[model samples]
Target: MRFPGKVERHAGRARDCGRHFTKTLRRAALAATCASVVALTGCDDKQQVAAAGPPPAVAVTVMTIASHGAAAQIDLSGRVEPIRTAEVRARVDGIVQKLLYTEGTDVNAGAPLFAIDDSDYRAQLEQANAMLQRALAVQTNAQSVVARFRPLVQRQAVSAQEYEAAVSAQGQAQASVADARAAVTLAKLRLERCVVRAPIAGRVGRALVTEGALVSAASATLLAQINQLSPIFATFPKSNTAILDLMDEARQGGLQLSKDIRFPVQITLANGRAYDETGEVDFADLSIDPATGAQSVRARFQNADRVLLPGQFVTGRFRIGERQDAVLVPSRAVALNAGGASVYVVGADDIAHLRQVVLGDQQQGQWEVRSGLATGERVIVDGWQKIAPEQRVRAVEQHGPGPGP
Candidate 1:
């Protein structure tokens, strides 16, 4: 009975050991699965790290620094006007009996432009001449009487009172002859005025008064307009501050305005074409306009071809001075920020840096760098928006198409 009990104990112990071994194997399998998962995760991490490299390079357009002549100019607008313009009017009241000039024709000075009905004027002139002739004959008779009376008085052939009366009558007759001559001269002047004439040589506008129109001296309509075409004037308004600055410059000898008061001027017509003839400064206003606070400047240009007309709107560009050794860049390279204008400058490491720049006048679609930019600096014009400061980037050289000859 003891042996059987011992055998049962041994069997139970064997079963318990088997169960313990099976539990150990299951725990070992679970641990191995966990180890494999951790190894796969570590491999994945290494592959991801190897795959992640430097950022891709940015594509951009750039221009190299170059030296060129830059001109400083002032831009303004103005209107063209005739150097001399006059309105033709009548001086005497009369009927427009004749029209001597066609509309829009050129007339010369002292040329007969119109003639009035001068029959009455001619008659008056004739009457005055007849009176003058009668007076001359009477004066001749008086002279003879005076000569005879003087001799008679001297010889005591007649009383002194009678000789004095004869002398007084001769003097009165001479005065009447002089008065008649003055009347004849006055009549001739009036007759001459009857034929209206141009006072100056110029192109004449349309005539306001026609033939058979009742006209008066004070109430006569405009006969026509005359405008001088050659040496035309360009009138432009400039700011008072600009005038003051120019004057200050002149005083400081920075500008040779006094010796050469005239400056070259270019005019842009309304059709966007530049005028063939260049102009020169003629006159500057002495006082500022009270209404606009601007001064008027007049420029003269020879317009023999009559290409410029009066009252035509035009734009003007005046070269004020020249900028020497000025640094200029493409206008597209300039970027505006919170502070001011800025540009992206490429460094030795091919990285971009922001540079603040001061700009001046624009010429040929390029901005003049007054300061903050030097020669031989590469400025990024395109793809700037994609770049950030201090970021590593690959820079590819961008070349512009060669300029035309």
Candidate 2:
């Protein structure tokens, strides 16, 4: 009986312990399940929040298309030159006596340049005059004899052969007088040549031959050089295609070639300063250079200030026409990508898109857009690197108006 009671008590204690272990396990499992469900829900909520947000906005400069007249121009480099240039030389062979004009001075036409030895020339003139007088006296005597012989021949008092000889003598005297007159004329020319004169009104260069230096007419040594400074010439080179285009425009009445082209010419000097005076297109070369395939065009400018010097290199611009209703943007707006030229345009949705454009000539710090952009479209001119294609951006109004006139 005592053993049976002990077994029953042990059985009861084991049953109670088994019930407690089952309850604890159930509670732990319930807590673990609830934690997993909350963690998953938090992750899903975070992902949803991230997807709803947009990409960062790009700060960029924007410009609008404007309606205005802008000129189309071709730029070229050339050299400044005098309108007229002449090398002064000695016309008569003699020792230089005096330099009549100072070096590098402005001289007028017919102004004395240099003086040669006139003493010898004067003596020759005197000799020529003396010879002329003697010839005149001899001619008078021959004429008197001829008159007497004519009458004698008619009256049969003188032989016909003698009368013929008298007539011949008179003819010889007349030939001698003509020869003397030529000699006098030659002497006068030589005297005039003794004083070298400037052929054109211009500025004179340095004197090449000094006083007491013997020079010859055939020698290469020049006395001086004169250059006409006012109304100077500028020679610039342009492509043959450009010339043809200009001609075509003239024929179409789009441009009047005969009118003064000076209004559109702008000159840039070597020092990067703009020339004050305007120039007119004076001449154009008929043929193109085979090597360069370029035609030279010459322009004339009134250089009254004498600022432009000969042989000075200068840049010039010739306005061909005015572009009407053209779209212009700042140079910075055009981006050079691997696919030629492109620009970033902000659409109405404030989203950026890369636009490929055809660019024409540049004018006044802006590029002339030929295609791919229409009026009223906003082009990003600044802050290009920060933006990308399809990226959302806030379009900010850039400072100031569009570039160029």
Candidate-wise lDDT, in order: 0.82, 0.85
Model 2 misplacement above 4 A: 1-61, 66-69, 242-263, 330-344, 352-359, 381-393, 396-405
In model 2, the Cα lDDT at residue 303 comes to 93
Off by over 4 Å in 1: 1-61, 64-69, 159-165, 245-259, 330-376, 380-405
Model 2 residue-pair collision total: 0
What TM-scores do the predictions have? 0.71, 0.74
Error of 1 at 40 (Å): 15
| Shift of residue 98 alpha carbon in model 1, Å | 3.0
> lDDT of candidate 1?
0.82
lDDT of 2 by residue, 161-250 (tens): 999988898999999999999999999998999999999999999998899999887874588899999989999999898778878866
